[model samples]
Target: MKRREFIGLVGGAAVWPLAAQGQQAATRVIGVLALESLPRTRASLAPAQRRLAEMGYVEGQNLAFEYRAADNQEDRLAALVGDLVQRRVSVIVAPAGPPIVAAKAATTSIPIIFFTGFDPVSSGFVASLNRPGGNATGISVLHTEVLAKRLELLRELVPRAKSVAYLRSSTNLVSDHDRIGKLQPAATALGVELLFVEASRPDDFEGAFAKIVSAKADAMLVSADAFMFSNQTALVDLAARHKIPAVYPSREFAARGGLASYGTNYPEAYRQLGDYLGRVLNGEKPENLPVQQVTTLQLVINMKTAKALGVAASPFLLARADEVIE
Candidate 1:
């Protein structure tokens, strides 16, 4: 968060006082490697912090959270990870996506904990789920595995829609192409055409939306990834301006006013992350800890947004939703 001066302020806030009182070992520090500004991560971070507190790891008494946020810049991640490593934190929390990659690369011995939508094994974050053979393990939602279901939900929200726009980040071309291949079968089965558009950087968003408009897509599916999630406000605004119904990968999007979202339970994932963090802090090796897979998925609908767009969510779908925003 406050990296410059605070980066130097580690061992922990309680470090100096405890050392002066001959009790320097009284605190444990959890270094967080965030991919966005600290404020942006508050929603995800709170649950983990609260869960930790419930487990008796109270801040300013027995715990400290030292963190480094890249402010949404992937390039800055390596340096931030390096700083966290240098701080000699008891545990490192990489907040999904690129930051995890950088954290793993930067440290092999330090215990690393993360919550990722990406497949942990294929992404090389772990050797296996049942037995993580390395110093990193946390919640794995495997969002790609649910792509088909997400598409089906979009069709449910936009019945009679023949064309749907799918917006994805273009930073990883090979992976994106692979993901698209997986989604095609679902599109074919639904008899809906998926118009693909991409934006890897902020500057490219306008052009991507222009392409979506030109394609005349009846609805949009914002792919699950940190890039899209971080820029959700802009994406939601663009969808509103275009008046195209859209379903997002994370509920935060629908909460920010996208039509709806059907994806992994994010806050729940972080709570699970907190549980693992506490486990590791209590002298457990990451290699011995099996990665936790979050199987719960949730649908969130914003009722006012649906009304504003002059679209009605299927009553059947509404009844099944975990939360419907008014």
Candidate 2:
């Protein structure tokens, strides 16, 4: 038997028939705080549930979950996280930067597992990757440094493009600033001009697309964030209506008919988070677990979107893509 199973068996032997002793029952609860209500965020929660089940924790038995979403409103996050803390959850799982920030501010005693794209050290989320030294610990997708490579690929796919419009969320200003600082120097070296458009809210997408058109950008790149991911369909439709080729940071964007996307697989990251949570629940400290970095990045292209934009995806780019939605 595994260590946890052995301990459970031995403990149960000593505390046999606790009900006979009239002892009250206790259940462990985990709280999940998501930045927005989106399919991708919902999809990520399943693997975590599955992992917990494998570790002998069953929902409605000894394990329970409290799920809350900000519904794409940045202002609602603090309230939602506070609600979870007030409920006194044993552990909290936060996906995306904003929700994680809110959870960190809400409690220091409860363990927090986060999935973020920014560098946790630079963002001050932790002391170090190897030694988080606090209740917060999980995975970092390390997105800031990859901006140049993503831009290079966009340039490769559209060699004649002189100007590129970059869409970013105003709420994630820290990430946006870091991305621009890294992207501009590489863009200059490639002789390409980068125009930034801010889409702080869903209503801003239409205006952002119009700005892209006015800038006469040959293509566009969207910075990764939960807000953008949540409104992906609207962005895809807008790009299609405007006939502007675009690149995104997740395959889900391309799957929804965006031109192309390149980034780490998000669902797999959640699965890893589940494993880490299991360790923590089994008496391991968060500080002892090193923060994970995603190594598998996927390249995806949508043939239909490319055709609609009147651009043929180069054979070289197509060959390198992990998935091609036709």
Candidate 3:
């Protein structure tokens, strides 16, 4: 994609028109609280806006968005959500796990929409999936359950891999620990030793890669989280520098030259979120709208990255992938 085209696709176009138009008398403003920076979070928002536009809510026309990015700082989320709540936004849209948690805590009266990988009910974000029973509901990607399958795919791609390094954000300790717990047995069953690496910031990436190399990990499976996703380019470069085949959770990784990715279609989920937001704005209650589960999944492989790592792409995997980067 051309630079301008990519920017528009990712919702990075200038917001001059949006700001100039201000909030219409009947237009409702939706607060978007993202856990990462604008550039990193744009990918998740583009599809949602497109979906909303299709549902008759045009930016600067019928709908206005109040966006705030925490830039991966957990400490700042509560304050950000509080500002949005004070602004009296018609609804709140949280892109990552923590932002959703913060939004839920910030207000109970305003409807909140979320795109999360964690179990809403288990995480205490909702009463149940079928009926959220509150002013919150959106979509679930079911990321935890896919741990086994991700490991299986990594092993399938690198059969002789004796060790696998798992990278996660150290800041989100609870989720990080839970993810490792879920993947440990699966790694053992596949006869692969699992090495854990925690890096909470961009500056920690080089050291983390050094640790991965020292641990003698033959491949890596990156844990899915907002922090990790924020440093996608850096992570992809480090994996390539170490010549270690790695798998990620989203196609954006593969698009940026990661070896492979297997997970829910994130853009589709965002589009669904937009549709649901439209419904909420049009006299529908969040509790009444059942939390939707992402049914479509995508597998993406980058042949160039595969070759750079000296690993040949398996024909079976290539055939099954939804997209391949040559």
Candidate 4:
């Protein structure tokens, strides 16, 4: 090689390692705790990853994940949070209220970005939505706040739905109280009798459905809870087997062939959560970042499920749906 070329090559080689080292140093590890099953969690996070990429975060290049899923097991959350805490990830992103609550209990100093269904202040996850005033902050979807809307949709779907069944997990009593308190008045106003059923685990699903059948519920409204999301398939299947019309709080349920669903766009909420995570990684304090409320309510209808249940989706309802799965 020529002498000048040899010197140039040596200088280039010397600079490469420094650049790689700096890139490695800039990389951040994000810990994720999901209360839903792993497959659902991954599916929900696809948009979040894309949003992060759009914001200049590339996994394995500058961002890393330490992911843990509860797989419908609420008891596993604490251990998962402990593992993430031990790893000392740059930020913890928890989707769903249970895992977020567990993460909050596990650490007060770790920066946590959570995607929740209820108000953060009422849930005690944060001091306030405007200013978190603590280490935890993220998005809140109006799950409990929209119980009346879900009931309205159910009533619309089944015009003769004089008896409506409400299903939720038994583990979160506080959420149950909040949900029931909101649902009762709406049920009365709609002239529908509400039958409440609780399922703490997957095994309890069958029994809960049996109770709904016995109660002769014309339709069902499933609460927006992590356990319910985790067991969505079973719930949808059971509702079909019993030939009952059901409305869920997430689009995933309708996509999975449930009768209908109405609520905030959760994947969009997760995308916002990813954005907040990136901001925290860039040195924004969780306390300074206001908790975000997802406002884009989506209505999803499954024509196939409706037809199978012998229910007609009116032209008006179909036109109003954000998405209709055939």
lDDT of 4 by residue, 228-282 (tens): 8888889999999999999999898998889999998877788888888878888
User: 5 in model 3: Cα distance from truth in Å?
Assistant: 48
3 against 4, candidate with superior TM-score: 4
Instruction: Count clashing residue pairs in model 2.
Output: 0
lDDT of 2 at 243: 86
lDDT of 2 by residue, 6-84 (tens): 9999998878887534432456788889987845566777887788788887778777878898887878888988999
In lDDT terms, how accurate is model 1? 0.85
Cα lDDT, model 1, residue 314: 80
Each candidate structure's TM-score, on Cα atoms with residue i matched to residue i, is: 0.89, 0.89, 0.90, 0.90
lDDT of 3 by residue, 1-326 (tens): 79988888667446755654564566889999998997767767889899889989998888898889988888899999999999999999987788988999899999999988877777777898888998999998857888778899998889989999988776443554566788988987899898888888788999999999988898999988888889899999888878889999989899999999999888888899999999999989999988899978888989888887778878888899899899
Clashing pairs in 4: none
Point out where model 2 deviates above 4 Å.
1-26, 38-40, 172-175
lDDT (C-alpha) at residue 124 in model 4: 86
Q: What is the lDDT of residue 122 in candidate 1?
A: 72
What's the distance in Å from true for residue 173, model 2?
5.8
Q: Which of candidates 2 and 3 reaches a greater lDDT?
A: 3
Quantify all predictions' global Cα lDDT against the true fold: 0.85, 0.84, 0.86, 0.88
> What is candidate 4's TM-score against the reference?
0.90
**Number of the top-ranking candidate, with lDDT as the measure:** 4
lDDT of 1 at 97: 68
| lDDT (10s digit) by residue, model 1, range 90-158 | 999987768888999999999999878777777788899989887999888857778888888888878
- Per-residue error (Å), model 1, residue 5: 36
Better of 3 and 4 by lDDT: 4
Candidate 1 weakest ten by summed lDDT: 170-179
